[model samples]
Target: MEREILLLGNPQLYEISEDVKKEELEDLRPVFEDMFDCIKGIRRDYGFGRAIAAPQIGIKKRLICILTDKPYVIINPTLEFIGDEMMELMDDCMSFPKLLVRVHRYRHCILRYTDENWEKQEMRMDDDMSELIQHEYDHLDGILATMRAIDNKSFVMKKYANPSLSK
Candidate 1:
């Protein structure tokens, strides 16, 4: 099933998501399936979504689906390390596709997460992948890119924003 991507005004987007227990992994397979479907649908409609957190679909679980070189599910993810280097980028979210926020993010990070089958895994990511994971991780913590904006001048409507700022 393809779930509806919750919008900015939705209060659920502001609430912290609960961590999914390893035992619940099997039961949440359907939610994972729906997340992937939702992401694909969003990419088809908007042309620019690489990942989505469970909260984006009204699922208050610490889960995220990322579409990178390969699609994969991450459950109970944690940022093990964030590099000192920072980069500023205009970030957009599935929840607020029409708005872009200029935010600072780590240039690299080490993330530890559990796979769909509850196997533990870790990956070091840099550049786009690092930014993407950090964005999704914020959703798990009830933080929006808008909240991380540099300042009042750091936001703009997608159409009015700089073309180079597309992320």
Candidate 2:
């Protein structure tokens, strides 16, 4: 099958991705390039996109690429939610563009992961950063924002959300 964006109905998106080994990093360089291109293209076409998980592109590997001021490459990432605080917001995904799902995420979190250079890295995130990383982390475990909707009425089209987030 062609390795392209896996949409909402793609079974591959629901499968739990495997952890990528450090030894595999070099070989996955091409995959990284494709992921950057994919996320950038989506952001360009849809007006919003911060990151993309490997499963979104039909690759069942625990990897995510965040394109902000610079690129953030997270491999085998794990999240640690801080405190008992939660923030509710509308979440969007590359897998299902323009379909927003309202969900609750931790207000603060610590993300630990392997970087592109194979170095250990951690980021203490709050607000938008926390929400963005949490959204991508969920994709590693076969979870989607749609599955975490607060209620049946939490779904909305991109244009309908009064104040859309860059999720």
Candidate 3:
């Protein structure tokens, strides 16, 4: 089933998500599958979206699925090693439609998560990949890009401060 991604102004995007518990494992798997498919479908059509979270799809769970070289699931991820270096990128969403926004995010980060098979894993991410992880992680924590989204006009003003800016 294709899940509908919640829009930027949706309240769910800003609410902190609850961790997945033991009993909900079975339920979350299919939900994860749906999210995966939804993200893939959107990315395939739009040529955008590296990651997506449950909240973005209106699931309100602490689950996020990212499509990297090896697309994988991250359940109740814990973020660390948030770097001082930042990157601003032009980002659009299935939820946000045609509006592109500039978002500031860490240039490097470390993440710990449970894989689809329930194996615990830790990974270091940098550049756009790091930004993608943080982006979806924000959705897992109920934050939307709009909260940090810069005005299209002001994007240039902030660009000099962060040369890695995008869009």
Candidate 4:
């Protein structure tokens, strides 16, 4: 199932997603499959992508698929900011692949979520992992990276921000 990722201006992208019910955990396999495939497509065409959220694929569920050395399915995640420290960086999204937004994100966080078997799990994330999780977590709450932009000057065309993207 190749699902089209909802674009930035889509109204549905603004709607908050619903939490996945414990009983529905078994049914998320295909959704995870589609999300993993979606991120692969994004990487193949756009050159960079690490994860995808259910909302990006119009699933309206609190789920995120992280595709790195291995795949991780985050279900109904909650984040606890570790401190006041923040880092500003250019963030991109599958919803608006060609755009980049300069935003500040917490440098560390405690991510708590339910795994595939519905067991509670937690991870202390920092650096890139922290930013990546925050990005996808925003999607579940009807938020986009653009909404977190530092200022009007925070937005830029991706090609200009990343020289490699110009290729």
Report lDDT (Cα) of residue 122, candidate 2.
90
The local lDDT score (0 to 100) that residue 11 gets in candidate 4 is 90
* TM-score, every prediction: 0.92, 0.92, 0.83, 0.94
| TM-score (C-alpha) between model 4 and the true structure | 0.94
Q: Give the lDDT of residue 98 in candidate 1.
A: 82
Model 4, 74-153: lDDT tens digits are 99999999989999999999999999899999999999999888889999999899999999999999999999999999
lDDT at 128, model 2: 96
Candidate 3 similarity to native, TM-score: 0.83
lDDT of 4 at 148: 97
> What ranking emerges by TM-score with the best candidate at the front?
4, 1, 2, 3
Clashes of each: 0, 0, 2, 0
For candidate 1, write residues 1-167 as lDDT tens digits: 88889999889999999989877888999988898898888776666788999999888999999987888899999995564999999999989888889999999999999998788999998988899999999999989999999999998876523454455
Model 3 per-residue lDDT tens digits across residues 1-167: 77877776777777888888767888787887788788777665555666788887777778888876777888889889564888879765566755666887888899999877778999999987787788788777666666677764523222222234334
* Per-model CA lDDT versus the true structure: 0.88, 0.88, 0.75, 0.92
Error of 1 at 100 (Å): 0.9
Off by over 4 Å in 2: 1-3, 160-167
Best by lDDT: 4
Which portions of model 3 show Cα errors greater than 4 Å?
150-167
In model 3, how large is the Cα lDDT of residue 42?
69
Candidate with better lDDT, 1 vs 2: 1
lDDT (Cα, 0-100) at 77 in candidate 4: 98
